[model samples]
Target chain A: MDHSSKRGDRPGVSRRDFLRGTGAAATAVASLVKVPGVEAQEAKSGADVVAIGPGPVKLSLEVNGTTMTTNVEPRVTLLDALRNYLDVTGCKKVCDRGTCGACTVMVDGKPIYSCTMLALEAEGKKIRTAESLIDGGKLDPVPAAFVACDAQQCGFCTPGFVVAMRAVLDANPKATPAEVEKGLAGNICRCGTYEQMRHAIEDLCKAGGK
Target chain B: MDNFVYYRPKTAEAAVGLLDAKWGTAELLAGGTDLVSLQKQYIARPKKVISLSQVQGLDQIEQSRGWPMTFKIGAGVKLATLAASSALRGSAAALAQAAEEIAGPQIRNMATLGGSLCQRNRCWYFRDEQSPCLLKGGDKCFALDGENRYHAIFTQGRKCVIASPSTVATPLMVLGAIAQVLSPKGKREIPLAEFFKAPTGPEDREHVLAPDEMLLSVSFSIASDKVKSASYEVRQKLSSDWPLVQASVAFELDGGTAKNVRIALGHVAPVPMLSAEAAKAIEGKPINEETAAAAGEAATSGAKPLSQNGYKVRLLAVAVKRALLTAAGAKKYWEV
Candidate 1:
C-alpha cells in the first residue's frame, strides 16, 4: 500500500521530485499552494505527471473548430462547460443524467452524452455540438430532412436527435433506415414524434445522394 | 457534484501513486458514466479524483500468438469499439453481442469496459442519498420488503438483493476471461469468475479491487475454432433500458454434440451467476428443443423468488434457452 518506496524503482523522475526541482525558492509554499496552470503546462511539455486543483484550473477546449479557454473545477461536466462557461449552448440539458440523450454531442467524430464526460477529459480533442450542424447558414441534410418531414413537436429532443442522426449519416451516408434507427436508439422522443421521425429517415434514405 | 482535486497521471505507475491508501478518500475516474452520477447524488464524495484518461497505452486491443492465441483488451476500450471489433466478433462473439445490446449509441460511445464492470448496482434505495439502505450501512434493506419487483430472486443468503447490472460481465464470465490489475505493489492476474463477489457487508464492493489498485486490461483465450458463443437479453423495451434478465452461453461443438458448455445469467443474482446445472444438462448432447428446454429449467433450479419478482424466474429460464439456441445457430422457438 505504501507506493512511495516503489516510485524510485521507475525510470522517470517522480512528480514530487519534479515539482521540487522546478521551484526551489517557493519549496515551502509550493506544495501547499497549487498554481493553476503550472503543472498542466508541464504535462503538455511531455512531463510524466500532472496535478491540478481542488480549485479552478485553466482549461482549453477546441469546440466547433474554435479553441476557447476558461477556468473551472474538475467536477464540471463537458455539457456545463459548454453551456455555462463557453457560451456554446446548442446542447440542451434535459435529464442531466446519461439516460436521456438530450445532451448528445460528437467527440472525435463519435456521438457521446456530453453530460457524462468531464471537461478536463475533453481537452486536446475535437468537440462538435448541435450548433455545428450548419455550414455557411445552410442547414445540414439531417436537420433539413427533419424540417421537411416535421419530425419534431416540442423541439426539446431535436438538437440531440439531429446531432446523433448526423453522426450516423456522416459515418455512412448510404446507411439504411434500419441502420439509422439502430444508431438513434440512444435518443428518446417523449413528445411522440417518432412517427414523423420515421418519415424523415425514409426521406433521407431515399435521397441517398444527400 | 462536489469539487475534488484532480490528478492526471501519464503512466500506470503514476496513477497508482496518486491513489490514497485509505479507501473512500480517493477514486479512479475512467469514463465518468457512473462516477459522475454518483457524485451528483452524493453517494460518492471522494476528496481526490485520479483520472486514468491521460495514462498511456490503456486503450489498445492487442493479440498475442501462442498455443491458445489470446486477445488482450485494455480496460479503457470503449463499448462501441468492443461491439465493432472484428477480432472479438470472430473469437468472442458473445462479448460483442452483450456490448452491442447495452444502453444506446451515445452511452456505448462514452462508457468504457472497466467502468461498466465496476459500476454499482441500480437499486433505487441505495442510490437515494437520504434512504440509508443496508448497502449504505443501514440496519435494513429497503428493496427486500418495499418495492421488491427488481430485487434478486436467487438471494443465496445475501442481505442486499440488488441484481447485478453489468451486461458485459455475464459474457465475460462464460468466456473465462482474466483481469489484469495493477496495484502500488505491482501487477497480478485474477480470473473473472473469482473477481466478482456478492457483497457480504456495507463496506464490500461488487468487485475485489482495492482502493489503491486499478484494472489494467482483460485477456481471454479461445481454445479452438469449434468454440461457439452468444448472448440473449430480455428487456421490457427494445430501446435504452436495462435487461430484465440476460443469459450468455459458450461451448465447443464436436461433430454433432456440445462439449464444455457454460451458461451465465445476469440480473437474477447479486453477481453474474454461473449455472453448472444448466451446463450439465447440455454437455455431451446435441443441442435441440428438448435439451435446451431442460437446460433452461435446470438454470432456475434453486431460485427462491421474493414477493413481487417471481416473474423474473420464468424470464431467466427463457433467456437461457434462447441463448443456448442462438449459440447453436438453431431455429428460434419463439420466431417459429
Candidate 2:
C-alpha cells in the first residue's frame, strides 16, 4: 500500500523492500538459526561422493554375493542400474512410478525401493537385489514356497515381490499371513496374487522362514 | 531432457550452503522417491539437485536425554527404517505404521523421512508429466476445475488442491513433533503442524521451508508409555496404494480415561489436520465406543469434501474412532 515503494505498487513488500527491511533483520535472525552439522558430526562418517555424470555415475553393488560396479546415467534407478549397468536383472521394473514394488532391493540388510534409489549413493554400501535370492540358479525356499503356494502370476512383478517377501520373512521370522500381508502391503501385484502370496508366507512359517 | 546437476552432501550445513547459494532455483533431493520421479515426469526441472543421502548423520535415529527424554530422527532416515525402528515402536507407533504404509519396500528404501514430509503433491493434473499445472507456475491450478476427487476438503477453496504427500509427518503432528531446519544463515525449529503452509494465496509453496533452508532433523518428546498411538489408513489395497484417508491418535491414559489426547487426519485435508475439538472430546473422559464415535464425529465436523471424496468423511470417522479406541487401550497389537 506504500506508493513510496515503486516496485509497481507491489501487493506485499517487493524484493527490493524485502532486502531493505529484512536484510538488516536477516543477520540477527540468521545467528539464531542452528547449523547442527558441527554438533552432530558423528551422523555422517566416511561418506562417499561419486559424480553422477553427464552420463551415468560409477556405481558399485555387492548384490547377493556378486560384487559389481559400472558407470550409469544420472537418471538410472537402482533397478535400471542393476539390470542395464550390472546385468543383475533379477529385480523387475514395472510401474516405475513406485505404486508397484517391482524393483525391491535390500541395502545393508534392509528392504528398499530400488527404482527410487540413486545408484551413486549405493557406493561402498552393501546391497542385495532380488537376484540374490537364487543360489547357483536355484530359487530360495521362500520363492520355492511361493511356487508351492502359487504366489505369482505372469512373473513380471515376481522378482520384486520375492525380494520384498524376503525382507519381510527376514524381519519377522515367524510371521503369519496377516503379518506378511501387512509387511508386504507396500508391494502390488496387478495380477491379484495377494492370496497366494499370503499362503506362501504361511507355508514359510510352517517351514520356519527357511 | 535437459541436464541437471546433482550434489550429494553428507552434512546438513553443506546442503544448506548449497541451497542458500542457489536460493529459489535449487532443490534438496531426499530419497529421490518423489524428486527423481518428478524429473522423469518433467514436473520439477530444477537446475541443481542437492542430495541429502550422504549428509553424514541425517539418517540416524536416537534417543535424547531430557526431563521428558525425546527421540530424534534424522531427515535422511528411510521409511522402511522408520517402520522397523525399535525407537519409535511404542511411543510413536502410529508414525511407524504410516511409514510402513507409504509405498512398497522399494520406494521406502529410497525415500527418506524428510523427502516424504517435503515431497510435492501427487495430483494427476499437477503430475501430468507434461501439462503445466498451477504448482509449476502455470496460471490455472488444474484441480480448480479439473478432476479433483483427490483434492483437499478442509482448506482448499479452489487455489491449490494438492493433498500433502507425507505419511509419517501427519502422525508426527498428532504427536506434536518438532522439525529442525538448517540453512546457510543458521537453524530454526517449528512444530510439525506449523511447518506446512496453507496454499491459500498466490504463493504456491507447500511448506514453510525457506528457499535457503534444509530440513536437518526432527525431534519430539512423548509420555513414551502412557501415550498409546496408532495409525489407521484406508487405502484401496494393502500394497498398490497411498491411503485414501489416514488418521492417527496419540492419547494419554488415566485409569482408562483419555487425557491430553491428540488427533490428526491426513489425505482428507490439505495438510495434516489437527482437531482440537476431537482431542477435547476424549480428554479427561473414558474412551468408550460412544465417546470414540463422538470423537470421530467431532474430527470430521464441517468437512467440505469434493464430489468423489465425500466418502472420506465416513472413512476418516472410522479411522479416527479406531485410532482413538486403539490409543486408549481399547485394542492392542492390531488384530492381525
Candidate 3:
C-alpha cells in the first residue's frame, strides 16, 4: 500500500496560519491584551520558568525523526496537532478521551494516547506515529502479521494496533501471545475483530520463534 | 476546552506561587490525562494552568537506608514505572499490584501517582455537564433517586454518593503512606488516611489540599520480611474498566496467628474506608476459610446500599476475604 499518498489531501495553508488570521479579526472587535516579555519576567524569578499565551504559540516537535514546527494554543492536544496541522494522520481520533487507544503514539519509546496529552508538553521529546511503522516503503513484520490473519474490518483501529504491537515487540522481541494481549489491552475495536486479532498474535509468536 | 495561559515552572515554589488563594482560579497540570478531559467537558475552567512537567527531580523514586527501609516516591512518577519497579515489587507488592490493575497500558503510561489520587469522582450525574448535581453546587444529588448502580454504598449521609475512584488509595492507606505537601508558607506531611475526605459542600474538593498547595511526594516505610501484604480487585471487565470492589490487606504472621492486621476497602465509600471490625475478626487468629469469611462479613457491617447497588455489598465482602487469604498465602478456595 502507498501510505505516503495520504498526505496529498492536506490543505496548503496550515491550520495555525488560518486561525491566526481569524484571531486577529476577532481581536479587533474585542480588544484582548497580548502581553509581551512575559517569558523574561518569569525567567528572572527562575531560570527555567516560562509562560506562553492564551492565543497561538510556536511549538517545535520531533515526530518520526523529523523536527516539525507549528503554532497552536495550549489547549490543543497532540493528536490534533499531528492530524490537523502536521498532516500526519495515521493515528485516528476515534475516542478523544484516553479510554480508546485509536490515537496511540510512542512518545519517548512509550505508547500513550495522543488525545490526552497537550502538544506543548511534547516539546523536546522524540515522538513516533503509526506512519513510522513502514520502513523503506515496506510494512513492518507486526503489520504484516495483521494482513496475514485479516485482523481488521473497518480498519479505523489498525494503525494503533500495529504501533502498539510493534512497541511490545521492540521492548521484548520474544514476547509471548499472552504478553502481547496484555500490552495491547488499551486498544478497542467496535467491529469485534478480536478473534482474528488473536490469530494474528499466534502467527507473530510463531514467526518470532525463527 | 477554553483557552488558558500556560506556565511551566522550574521549581515547586514557583509553581505554588502562581496559584491563587481562592479555588478554581489556577489549576495544576500533572500528566493531563484527567485534567484535559475535565476541561473539554467544561467541568474545570481554570484561567491559568501551571505545568509541573518541567520541574526537576519530581519523577524520581528513591529508597533511603535505615533501621526500617523507607521509600519516597515523587508525585510525578508515572504509574507504569510504579508497576514495573523491582524495588516496589519486593518491598510493597500490594501497591505494585494495585498500580498494575488501574486503567490500561496507554493510560498507565501517561497517568501519574498524584493525578490518580486527586482525580474527581466518576459518578454519571456529576460527570454530565447539564445535570445540576450536588457536587457541582446544585441543590440535590441525582444519584440518590436516579440510576445509581455505580454509586457509593457507604455514603455516611454526606449528600454526594460518588465512590472514590483511586485504586491505589486502598493499598496506600493499608501501607500507612504519608503525603508531603508544599505551599507558599512551608511544607507539611499529612497521613494518607486524613488526606482523603468526602466533599461536604458545593465548594469542597475530594482531597484536603488547598488551592495554593501542591503534593510534592509520598513517603512510606517498606514492609519487613515478616509482613504479608496483598491486593485484590473485582471488575466487570479486565480491560480499562474501574473496579467494582477492591480490598488491600497487610498483617504480620507470628507463627500461625495473624497480628497487627490492617484492612482497607475501595469503590464502596466516599473515601477509602478502613474497617476496624474487619481487622478485629482476623486478628490473633489463624487465617483460614472460617476466619477469612468472618472478616469479609464484618467489612460490610455498616454498608447502606443504595437502590441499585446492593450487589456491591456482597462483592466487597468477597474481595476482603480473598485479599486476606492471599496475604496469608493460603489456598485459593474460589479457584476450586
Evaluated on chain B only, candidate 1 has a TM-score of: 0.97
In model 3, the runs with Cα more than 4 Å from the true position are: A1-48
Q: How well is each residue in B51-108 modelled by candidate 1, as lDDT tens digits? A: 8988888889997665476888999999999999987888888999999999999988
lDDT of 3 by residue, B189-238 (tens): 99998988887555778899988999999988855767778899999997
- For model 2 chain B, the run of ten residues with the poorest summed lDDT: B17-26
Give the DockQ (2 decimals) of all models: 0.35, 0.20, 0.51
Place model 2 in a CAPRI quality band.
incorrect
Query: Which candidate wins on DockQ?
Result: 3
lDDT of 3: 0.86
Clashing pairs in 3: none
Better of 2 and 3 by lDDT: 3
Task: Give candidate 1 misplaced runs (Cα > 4 Å).
Answer: A1-47, B65-67
Which structure among the candidates has the greatest TM-score?
Answer: 3
Q: Quick one: ranking by DockQ, best first?
A: 3, 1, 2
Cα displacement (Å) at residue A143, model 1: 0.8
> Where does candidate 1 chain B have its weakest 10-residue lDDT segment?
B63-72
Model 1 pairs whose backbones collide: none
